[model samples]
Target: MNPQASAQRGSFRHRLVRKKRMANSNEHNAAGYLFIAPWLIGFFLLTLWPIVRSFYLSFTEYSLLEDPTWVGLGNYSEILFKDELFRTSLGVTFTFVVFSVPVKLFCSLMVAMALNKSIRGINFYRTAIYFPSLIGGSIAVSVLWRNMFDLNGYINHVLGWFHIKGVGWLTNPDTSLGTLVLLNAWQFGSTMVIFLAGLKQIPQDLYESAAVDGAGKVRRFFNITLPMLSPVMFFNLVLGVIGSFQMFTSAFVITNGGPVNSTYMYALFLFEKAFKNYQMGYASALAWILLVIIAALTAINFLMSKYWVFYESEGGRAK
Candidate 1:
């Protein structure tokens, strides 16, 4: 072959090979997108779209039966100014979050500390302690709680054995919310597991060194264990606050926000407005308010974490 012809043929072959490789790369990219398409579609339709639509609905007057009519900030105004139930529910929810989150965290940490020991049947103990959390939020559990706390139920029966009178737990306004808080604290299993995981990550040398320094178990825990577990504690605190704010099922199924709305959680109020009263617009406003509250609290937690959440990478100081 002539030299010029040979050069042209070689160049054409190189271009063809490059084009083939480019096509294969495009095909792989398309396949990857196809694999993730379901999740993308669900996120847009089920999550993102509802969030946007709810925000829009919050500004309108809409019952399920009627077309939405723009009401500007009327719903928000009514909720803030005219609604006594709104304030009551908000207070109740805040109380629940304040009491339940800390109690649950403390109880979970204590149980986790016990479970972290090298005792016999430790796996079984862990499972037994964790089992309640798995089913604690279920309707069946709520029903059981209601029966247990009833005036003449098993709790009162047990009290009778000691000649002690049992107060109406889920009946009186004073004790009703406390029952829910106790229920929440009892289901500390998941938090316990997280604490256990954090405990396992602490270096044994740290404990040994503290012991060698004539430090007691309590001193070592304060100097070593707590600092190492601060990140996990912060994680659980944020999650617990968020979860407590959204508490609904227990109040709904157990107390039904009864005894003068004492146990009326903000979420329960929102549900009643949307579904029972058919005031979808007001409910949407309440929902958005809840979202804002959760976001703000989470942001504050993150900010405050810099003061308390110790990190080993930062030499045991929060960054």
Candidate 2:
């Protein structure tokens, strides 16, 4: 056989093998897309379309009963300039975030540290503590919380033992917001779980070394645990801030944003505009404003995180 012919035959076979592999790769890709088609369709139809539609609706005058008329920035202008309720709601939301996020994070970290210890039935204790998170956001729980804080309710009954008379927690203007903040703290179970997971990742040797260096518990926690936990704390802080800004269920069901609108949260305001007044356009604008506020805060958090979020792998603050 000619050497040239042999080379030509080998080249042809190589091309054929390459073509076969390419065909198989294409088939695999097609099958993968087919498997994810449902998710893609659901995302577009249920999630993305609504988001786009709402953004479009935000620039119009929509009352749900009438066809939406294009108003450009009219809705946003009105909400920003003419809406007193919007300002009140925004102020209330800011206050809620300021009070709730720190309290929730502190409670979560404290509870997580306590539960991180090894003891008999520790698992049971963790489960019991975490169980509230499963049902914490439900309407039933909000109603129960309302009743518990009522003037003649469970909280007052409990306080009576100590001769401390309870005020109308959800009804008073001064205390209504505080009650909601307390409720937000009560839902710290999920945050505690995240903190606990982060705590577990920290090396035991670090604590032992600190102890050997004559560091007391307070000093050790501030110097060791906090730096190690800073990354987790940053994560929880961002989530807590976002969630607190959108807080609604308890405020709506418990206080109804009442007592001179003292607890008139942004979410409750958005809900009332969209549903009660059927002002979809105004509501959409409010929603976008809230989104921007959250985005701004999250961006600030990311920018500031480099100063505090110490990554163990990086051996210092995250770059």
lDDT of 2 by residue, 1-319 (tens): 9999999998888567545334444667778889999999999999999899999999998997889999999999999999999999999999999999999899889999999898789889888888878888999999898889889998999999999988988889999999888878888899999999999988898899989999999998999899999999999999999989988888888888999999999999999999999999889989999999999999999999998888877865343
**Candidate 2 runs further than 4 Å off:** 1-27, 316-319
Shift in Å, residue 17, candidate 2:
21
**TM-scores for the candidates:** 0.89, 0.87
Q: Write the residue-wise lDDT of candidate 1 on 234-277 in tens digits.
A: 99999999999999999999999987899999999999999999
**Which pairs of residues clash in candidate 1, taking residues 3 or more apart in a chain or in different chains?**
none
Query: What does candidate 1 score on TM?
Result: 0.89
lDDT of 1: 0.93
Clash pairs (backbone) in predicted model 2? none
